[model samples]
Target: MAAVGIAVVLGLAALLPTAALPCGALQPDNTTASKLLGTWLYVAGAAQFPQHLLELLLIANGHLQVEPGAGEQELPVPQRVAVGDQCLTNNSTYFEIAVGNTTLVKHAKTHQTVGTLMNLSSEDVLLIQYQLQRERTYLGLYLYARNLNVSTERREELERYAKCLGLSEEIVYAPWKTELCQVRDIEKGNSPCREPAAVVTASPPPGTHRPGSAGN
Candidate 1:
């Protein structure tokens, strides 16, 4: 069984495209920025890199709450994800809207990820093509929606978009069976499902403001 699993992984890695294909970009503007506000549930994801694909496989379900930050260009994103039996929460990362509809997210001041909003057929769905740099470049696509129940047509659309980006058709969907972390519990710092060791909290940079603060 172990050998078969390794073989399957290696086969998938070999199928990855060496270079990413061109895809339509969503121009960043006030209208687009406003659309990003509020809560979004993680529906599905696809990736060109094997490591990122593995990361997507681990997420059973997740959601993100976006709020306006101190600056107009900054968006504070509070994220919660369920992995296996553990729930992980992070409230420090911020997404900055950059030129060309691209968003920059800094993770613990360690590695920066650049994500470009992609044009999707459905207005209710948001598709982001992202590239993360660490030792090497990793490319992936994230699909978020206002509601958790996604249609079959939407899933098909995502598969087509993934193919256009030179990513394999094997998209991973977060199971809806898992309950999302409650906002009230998160605010009170007493979520029942939250794993103590998995909790990640950090202060915003000196000039920035945290979500739900008066400065926001």
Candidate 2:
């Protein structure tokens, strides 16, 4: 009778809801770092703040290239985005791996934004959450993929995750028809569209929210 009682208690404990952990807590590892070494396309994003949401809405399409930085502590990320009729490129930003999967992105040694990397159900999709001013209350969630677009299931998953994060249900999806700026063109400064002078700004202009905009 005592053993049966213990078993029932254990089963009840297992059935009880556990406290939800902050996103990316204890999830980053060497495998995740390796997976982030290549390029990823921005799929959709949501934010708790309106400024961040506006930033996401302005982006037609965006591409991010992640490269291993000095040692294992840093990852250099270059990004190019098509906003309106102009292409904006920023190559001076890098993320420093702060304990575990937490990252601190710095631009021109000025702005600093804290973020975390979380892997979703699909291997091709990655979710990044940027905390506002180091607080979780106001944050933005951006989803990236190895491919140009993700499936409806993946988008639904993002919506669920956003809800869990207390972000707005309205997600801004980058249009698929917009031509993404080529990395080579961006590097060569030869894109046909109006190319802006590379600036040290970590986040985009007000309107859509972007990753690494925590400090902004």
Which segments of candidate 2 are over 4 A away from where they belong?
Answer: 1-21, 98-111, 134-138, 183-216
Candidate 2's displacement at residue 164, Å, is: 1.7
Find the candidate with the highest TM-score and give its number: 1
Global CA lDDT computed for model 1: 0.58
- Cα miss at 122, model 1 (Å)? 2.7
Tens digits of per-residue lDDT for model 2, 57-160 = 77777777788777766787766777655555566556666545445444434444434565577778867765433223346677889886689999998898
Q: In candidate 1, which residue pairs clash?
A: none
Runs off by more than 4 Å, candidate 1: 1-21, 49-54, 98-111, 180-216
Candidate 1's TM-score reads: 0.68
**Whole-model Cα lDDT per candidate?**
0.58, 0.57
What's model 2's TM-score? 0.67
Model 1 alpha-carbon miss at residue 26, Å: 2.0
How far off is residue 98 in model 1, in Å? 4.6
Candidate with the greatest lDDT versus the true structure: 1
